[model samples]
Target: MTTTYRVTLRNRNGVPLDVAEDEPIYAAALRAGIQLPIACNYGGCITCAAKLITGHVRQPKGTALNRRQSQAGFILLCVARPTCDCVLDVGVESHRGLYQNPFAIAGNRYPPDA
Candidate 1:
């Protein structure tokens, strides 16, 4: 049987994507072009941390996570799976300044089809 999950995220831009029962949330986001920030794909890193505003998550087997963080509503999407309809508060405040930069990125001038 196939497992389908309901994922509601922070903003309209943060549309939820589909994830297979066994697939990692990070992998699912990547497949859907969500560009979720992640460094180590393993639980060793907290770069992909997101807040589960609602619902439950099932972590991978043998993974280690701090109970305090869990209680505080933090989740590492790189290794998390929803056990019910979920809403996540993504994009941490630490990275908010980056989004405010208007001149930070200079896109390619040449046309890709040229």
Candidate 2:
């Protein structure tokens, strides 16, 4: 039997998307006809930045998030595949001002100080 985990992703409006563990969060959202903030699907852009509120994910090595950001629970939905059930907060509003750098906040550029 194949095992699959549930992933719940939320936006600023408290909207939630149910994603699959083996799929990228963005792709799951797209498959469900949900429009999420995304630029590059390769994890170069921070447009798809999200916070991992619960559970775990296997993020691509190319993800723009730094060690600090990763430790702080940041994940790139475009390249993040859930390793288990997960809950992610999407968009800058979801960050609640934890990150100050526009690039880091936006998930596009990595801050040197980070």
Candidate 3:
């Protein structure tokens, strides 16, 4: 059995969405009629960047964020999977100035190759 998590989307006004432990938040949000900023679906860009307001997310394949950035509550929803119930502020690609830049990047350029 898969563990399902409830993620409250701030952009959607506290609408609740469910996602399996192994399912990415992006996919789950879409299924719940919620849309988040997204570009490279492979986790190479900040287009799908979001802020983790509370709880935890498993971003094992998300390369757009380094450990420091993740620790700062930043997460790429396109590749983030909820580990437990969480609250997230999505569609935050335009808020770059609010965050400090990371010295190390785990991904390629803006538009990652397929």
lDDT string, candidate 1, 1-114, tens digits:
979786766654558776766667777778877777787887777777777778888777414345545556677888888777788777664232212232533463222211
Prediction 2 TM-score vs. true: 0.72
Cα TM-score per model: 0.71, 0.72, 0.77
Please give the range of 10 consecutive residues that has the lowest summed lDDT in model 2. 105-114
Error of 2 at 42 (Å): 0.5
Q: List the residue pairs that clash in candidate 2.
A: 46-107, 46-108
Model 3: lDDT of residue 63: 79
- With candidate 3 superimposed using the best TM-score fit, by how many Å does residue 110's alpha carbon deviate from the native? 22
**lDDT on C-alpha atoms for all candidate structures:** 0.66, 0.72, 0.76
**C-alpha root-mean-square deviation, each candidate:** 12.5, 5.5, 7.2
Residue pairs clashing in model 1 are none
lDDT of 1 at 64: 38
In candidate 1, position 15 carries an lDDT of 88
Native-vs-model 2 lDDT?
0.72
- Which stretches of model 3 miss by more than 4 angstroms? 93-114
lDDT of 3 by residue, 28-64 (tens): 9888877777899978887788888899987766777
In terms of lDDT, model 1 sits at 0.66
lDDT of 3 at 104: 38
Model 2 residue runs over 4 Å out of place are: 10-18, 98-114
